[model samples]
Target: MFENLSERLEKSFKLLKGESKITELNIAETLKDIRRALLDADVNYKTAKTFTETVKQKAMGQNVLNAVKPGEMMVKLVHDELAVLMGGTSTDINLKGSPSIILIAGLQGSGKTTFTGKLANLLKTKRSKNPLLVAGDVYRPAAINQLQVLGEQIGTTVYTEEGCKDPVKLAKDGIAVAKKGAHDVVIIDTAGRLAIDEQMMEEISAVKKAVNPDEILFVVDSMTGQDAVNTAKEFNDRLDFDGVVLTKLDGDTRGGAALSIRSVVDKPIKFVGTGEKMEALDVFHPNRMADRILGMGDIVSLVERAQEQYDEEEARKLQKKIAKNQFNFDDFLKQIQQIKKMGNLKDLAAMIPGMGKMLKNIDFDDDAFKGIEAIIRSMTPAEREQPSIIDGSRKKRIAAGSGTTIQEVNRLIKQFDDTRKVMKMMTTGNKMGKMMGKMPIGKRR
Candidate 1:
């Protein structure tokens, strides 16, 4: 996700290293490099030029503080400007009307259907809105079926006519169904062509005119880079979309669409599709994204994800169990489940400051926790409650049951024991602090 651009920008900032102040002379090379970095990331040439100019003007005008180095000051200026380029702040979708209508439009293969499902799931779970998914794609084969599957997976009713060829009528009837069902929102998934055509544009226009949707979201595949921005502009010209949805952002995207679409289309990026899962949709936040691009990480989003899966009652009970030294394999397994529910492992890791660059070379398997989960599941309930009861024979049996080796089981047990000891120390805060104080410097481990 803009890894190359981030590296280039970091290198550009290094141009100011050891400089006394941000003079135009010292900053010329850095600004050039920053502009080149943006261009390489497929940003609009004009936008890139304008951004660098704005950054330079601000850098030269501001008085640098003694505590802040030239390089550090430059980075701060670029970060804020990048945020402004991406829309300055997040924009919420309008849900003002009763059974608010949201029209989804895009070129074919833009993840329109998938994003529709994700949006429905987001509104249903987060906003407490009863959403009705409407399958408006009648031309494409199995488009309706695909939406139906997604609707079922998200536990939302999908409104589809068995053999309706008229998308405008389908959308209209879908909204009617929402009103009938007392649904708070109606998301109509419109059809798309491989390329934009007059017929396609006209058909979508008709639907828009008929429905008078509260929001029309133009979804685009972010991996397409500048093409995504161009497609968004074309769609906006016809439909005047309310927002943009950049899908497949978790892929190897250069991030041009996210950075350029807002400025080009004059619409805020309302959402981003980070992964394939229905729960992967995120409300686009300019500052957080700028932080990610600058390798600053997004700790606020990380905490928000954790809080979503957090349960106050369960947390209090877990704390008590840890304080009493009663945290067991079952509790450990439950903790793993909670983490897994938070979203993709690598995505979560990237939310931590500095972890993105550190883990960029590592490949995270979707089943990364499978072995540990299997091993824990293989244990008897009694053994899970009291792991000390497991002896040599029990280790062999559990390893065989989990399709693992005895050494693997032994390694897990060692790790678990260490984790329990550390957890106990953490619960006893002063004791843990004193232990840290007693440890020899540079030999703490």
Candidate 2:
């Protein structure tokens, strides 16, 4: 998302290359470039100035270790400052009340409804909370229906009073229903106007007072740049929200709002909406985000996503199968499904250090596994369990069923067999030489 800023920052560091230390004389132009990069990214002018100034101070005061290059030292200082500029640490949403009331407030097109559903999914899956979604956006037609659709997708309950025009009353009543249903979390999605207005402000403010939410989150569209910051300020003045939620971050966002909102409103960003999926909500981590912005990649977050999809019991079972050389196409298909659950293919690849730069020009299609999955699905159950049983005629039949060439089917079988052999050798701790000897030597005929 900060692709332009990352490139600019990289170039700025290059200005300090070949320098022995970060002296004022040598660092001035570098700092200027950094500030310009921030401004071009749509960061608030004052924030950009303060950030660069603080970074310059830190860079100048630090001792340059012989082991570390001057450019590398400057990068470290800027990364730390960027983290501080973006709230210094991640904040968790408050879910401490009897039924934690989370009121979502934002502009009409800011993705409030979608975020509500995502938040519920997060609580249900990660936090183990029974969340009840309340469709309180009565002013927007079909808003309630949209939330209901999301609720259904996440398997959460949506509490809506059809024909009830009073959002404040609806919110209050929704909380009551949550109490009766023993729902531990109540997320109330409120109405928003095209722009901030007296009626919109007063209405949400009244609803806040009525419900006394445990957490009031102002969702903003990150693509709006500085306008998002201004809207956050106005909302904070009235609602005094607990934290901010930046949505549509995966879109064509300049990333100014994310880098500026916390500083402008003096609030932590609790979460960010990365994509359209209900599982796309991520708890904001400032240091990790700083890493991503600097093109350093976010390995910690990548591992966490992998852990979320990891099943210990399943791993044990799979290990046993691999040890016995029984890692067939069905097992391979399950592994692909686990990877797919981790998120976007390109995004996942970007999490690995250095992969982002390598894939910067590559268009990673999300459906890259479609062909493999289709081929596997085309197999008969018996063939899936016993892939070796497939012969020449079976290959032709599978190719036609999967809409692929017979050669493609043979290639997949060859790949699967080679993968199984490699995995078996690794699990068995076979010597490197022996493993290489056991590897398949030629292409499938």
Candidate 3:
């Protein structure tokens, strides 16, 4: 994400590579390159110029402290300015009211529906809120159904009325239903138009007036670049949305929308849609984003994702099984599934503090456990519980039945045994492991 812009900014900083102090001349050269990089990345030209001006003034005015080098100082100054430009701090979704109403607004194909589902899941799991997803997109039956499937996947109730043509009424009734069901959050997914049309604007505005929503999030496709900023402005002018949701940030987004939207509309970016999964939503932090733009990986977010996926109950249950020596193929497969659900393997692997640059070209399949899963599926219940029951002859038969070579099956068993040993160490001496440890297994393997 923003790789091109990251590369460009890194090059701009090189102008101060070996300088003891920043001068106006070197700062001018660096700011010129930075301005061009921003323009190339589809940032608003005027905003880019203003950004460089701020950066340059600060670089020239600041006393280059003895503790930091010129390059480090420039990076720090630019990072701070970028954070302020993108709204100095994160703004959380307002869920204060009983059955707090959240209205989703955006253009067609802006991923409004997907984002609604994701937001509902986030509220339910992360915030411990009982959320009711409301289908307010009456224009498309498919849109309602899509939301239904997402609600089903997340185990949330969806409120919808058949043939309800009025989105305002649907949203009102949806909130009523949420209140009746003791839900704490109500997320209404509103309709979107192909472009910023009058009808679309009026429809969403009516919903806003009727519901008196606590939060109205304008979802914009980051890939839309400048158009995203303009659309945000249009929506904010009409509904005065509380925050912005930038979707499709995982793709080759030109960074313009993110850089300009806040400065343009004066609304903090509440969250970003990094991927299509319900688990892909992240609260936007300006300082953290600035770090990512400067090629520093987001380790904080990476750790949070892991913590969310690691269930305490499941860990305790597995630990008991390990002590009893009852850990089996089925348990190992379940662990793999849990890890895959956390996120994309390649992206998650790149989040370790020092592993991003190293794993850039290494291809790690999330489905690397597919063969092992198949092999385990072929085994009988007894064999799964007791691998020793599958001797040499049994292994040959299992391999043939599972459509894998005997050697491949043997490798999986050996890997599983090794994994158990490592897990025992992790559970038994967790503190010792943290203090005297090597890298995570993912990195070493």
Q: Report the C-alpha displacement of residue 69, candidate 3, in angstroms.
A: 1.8
TM-scores, all models, native as reference: 0.95, 0.95, 0.89
Model 3's TM-score against the true structure? 0.89
- Taking the tens digit of each residue's C-alpha lDDT, what string does model 1 give over 1-445? 8888989999999998999888999999999999999999999999999999999999989999999999999999999999999999999999998989999999888999999999999999999999999999999857889999999999999998988999999999999888989999999998885335988889999999999999999899999999888878878888898999999999998988889988888899999998988888899999999999999999999999899889999999999999999999999999998888788999889989999999989999979899999999999999999999999999999999999999999999999999999988788998778878998899877
Which model is ahead, 1 or 3, in terms of TM-score?
1
After superposition of all CA atoms, the RMSD between model 1 and the true structure is 2.9
lDDT of 3 by residue, 1-445 (tens): 6778877898999988888899997778889998999998889888998999998888888998888999899989988998898999988878889978888998988999999999988988888999999999999999999999999999999999998999998999998888889998999998886445887788888888999999889999999999889878877888899999999997778899999988889889999988878998999999888877877877888888878889899888989998676788889878878787777776676566446556655777767767888899888888888887888988898899889999998998898889888777666687776755667766653
Which residue pairs does candidate 1 place in steric collision? none
lDDT of 2 at 374: 96
List the candidate 3 regions with Cα displacement exceeding 4 Å.
Answer: 317-327, 362-366, 400-403, 424-445
Candidate number achieving the greatest lDDT relative to the actual structure: 1
- Model 1's alpha-carbon lDDT is 0.92
lDDT of 3: 0.86
Query: Per-residue CA lDDT of candidate 2, range 1-445, in tens?
Result: 8888888999999999898877999999999999999999999999999999898878878888999999999889999998999999999988889999999999988999999999999999998999999999887768889998999998999998878999998999999999999999999998876445888788888999999999999999999999999989988998899999999888778899999998999999999998888888899999999999899999999999999989999999999999887878889999999888788888888888778888878888888999999999999998999999999999999999999999999999999998888899788775766766776888323
